[model samples]
Target chain A: SQQGEEDPQALSIQEGENATMNCSYKTSINNLQWYRQNSGRGLVHLILIRSNEREKHSGRLRVTLDTSKKSSSLLITASRAADTASYFCATGAQGSGNTPLVFGKGTRLSVIA
Target chain B: DAGVTQSPTHLIKTRGQQVTLRCSPKSGHDTVSWYQQALGQGPQFIFQYYEEEERQRGNFPDRFSGHQFPNYSSELNVNALLLGDSALYLCASSIRGIAKNIQYFGAGTRLSVL
Candidate 1:
């Protein structure tokens, strides 16, 4: 079973616009990471932010985690057609190993170019 | 230079039959895990294997069994398949056990049960 849920199940935006997706989990975590999936194929690792950290940035991606709220958000700056894909947030629970990341339902982003 | 790879990108099987899905871990990886994702749903954990043993499993029944070979390649077998079993079978590999590990995934095998 999946331990997290993502909102805006689906989103559509135009090129050059920014996109934001939110994910909420049910348990404590050691680290929260984001992934991207093209179609129903394999998933691509994005960024991982540990629980002790509140925010992280890499290139055009920004991820924020609020442990008090048990949630996290991923922001994509300057969306492009290549950014269209399903984004998922996964967490390695506090006591759980990072091996199998508990994933969320995912948010589908469609960037219109 | 090869990433994780799964054989038979697509498969079709009938209900009540059995099927096998294979996976080859990325070079230098020693752990393999399996997941099942139904249409429009998140992937569900199946099991994890390391050093030719079943290390951990999720809620799946005994009908779902797996094996990790000495070579670090793996195979997932399911018996008495149901339509609900038709899903994307994903295989992920890691350098060590699942705990505190980052798993790399394969393209997955799309199984369709008729």
Candidate 2:
């Protein structure tokens, strides 16, 4: 079963614009993380926000977590053509000691130059 | 330093056949986890290993099994292969302490069950 479901399935934006992707999960989580995957490539970790954190930032990425609503959002500011990729949200289920992360289908973003 | 590594970037198999995929974790990492990603879907956790022991599992059936070596490398084996098993299999490695769940993934093995 998928723990996270990304909203807007896909997004297209111009370079220099900001792209936002949302993810909603069903269970309590110890942390929520965002990752980026270029076509046919392995996923690269973007940023992680712990349950106690409301938001986090890394380079051009901003991640916000709303544990009460079981949702999170990832914003990529100054989107670039190089940022064209699929973004995924993964959750480490609360109390699930040492379990692998449960991921979402992801949002496919296309940045037009 | 080398990150996680997976072998045989691709594989083809038939129904009722068995296949094995391999992974070598990043240096100093001790845990290995496997995930299955179908086209247009997220990677689903198959199982995790630590200290050569199966520490946790997802909803996958018994046909999906794994082995972890003393060197912290691992293998994912699937028996009675079905078309539905055709997907990208990923291997992720992480440390055991404060970074327990922050995994580094290897380029997945693309499996095709014919």
Candidate 3:
């Protein structure tokens, strides 16, 4: 079963604007991570926030985790056409060690210049 | 100096045949994990290898299996391939300490099952 699901199936925004995507998971997680994948490319890790952390920031990306609600959100500031890609949220379930990851059906973001 | 690398870049296989994909993790990473991503879908975990042992697995069946070498390189072997198995197979590697799960991924091997 998919552990998490993204709210918006797709989003479109202009360059310089901001985009937000949300994800919700079912089980207890040790941490939540966000990744971006360009069309026909490998996924690039964005940022990870541990269960004990409520928020984290890396470059232009901000990730917030709400452990109590089993949800998380990713914010990309100053969007660029270069940022156009599929964004995925992943949760590492506490017990499933060595398991690759339970990824959500991502939110496709389109940044138009 | 190198990141995780997965090979062949692309492959074509026939249904009922078998195929093997390989990966070499980033330096200092001891665990290798594999994920399958269908077009327009998020990646699904297949399994993970640590210390040359299968440590955890996803909901996938036995037809999907893997192995990790002492050098931390890995291979994913799919037997009796099905068209449904056609997807991008991804490999990720991570260290084994407290930062056990921050995986760095390879570009992924695109597998086409005819």
Candidate 4:
């Protein structure tokens, strides 16, 4: 079963515009990580935000986690056509002894050139 | 350094047949995990292996099992498969003991159970 729910199941935006996706989970997480997957391919790790950390950034991606609200948002600044792909949020449980991460259904982003 | 690798990019099997899928973890990675993704759905965790041992398992039944070798390579086996079992089987590798270790995935094996 998936632990998280990603909002805006699908989004389409023009190039250079920002894209924002949100995720909400029900459990107390040790960390939350985002991943990207091109069609017919495996996932790629994007960024991870620890429970104690509220926000993190890498390249044009900015992720903000609000543990109090049990939600997180991923923002892609100046999105490009290459940014088109599915984004997923996975939650790692706290002290679960190497338990596997639970992922959300994912949000599909389409960037128009 | 080579990333995680999986064999048999695609497979076709009939119901009740058994199949084995293999995976080799990325260099220096010691943990291997398996996931099943049905079409139009998120991947679901199957199990995780560390130190060549099955450390944790997800909601899957006994039909799904796996083995981790000393080299941190892994294989996922399914017996008496059902048509519903058809999906993308992914292998992910990560170093153990790192807090929230980032997992690297191999292009998954697409299994089609008829």
The models' CA-based lDDT, in order, is 0.91, 0.91, 0.90, 0.93
Worst 10 residues of 4 chain A by lDDT: A92-101
RMSD value for candidate 3: 1.4
Off-target runs (Cα >4 Å) in candidate 4 are none
lDDT of 2 by residue, B51-71 (tens): 999998999999999999999
lDDT per residue for candidate 2 within A24-92, as digits (tens), equals 999888888898888956888888888999988899999999999999999999999999999999998
lDDT of 1 by residue, B1-114 (tens): 899999889999999999999999999999899999887877778999988999889899999999999999999999999998999999999877344467789999999999
Which one is best on DockQ?
4
> Alpha-carbon error at A70 in model 2, in Å?
0.9
Backbone clash pairs in model 3 (N, Cα, C under 3 Å; residues 3+ apart or in different chains), count: 0
How high is the TM-score of chain A in model 3?
A: 0.94
True contacts kept of each: 0.54, 0.59, 0.53, 0.56
- How well does candidate 2 score on lDDT at residue B70? 95
lDDT for B36 (candidate 1): 92
Please report how far candidate 2 places residue B84 from its true position, in Å.
0.5
What is every candidate's alpha-carbon RMSD to the true fold? 1.4, 1.1, 1.4, 1.0
Interface RMSD of each: 2.4, 1.9, 2.2, 1.6
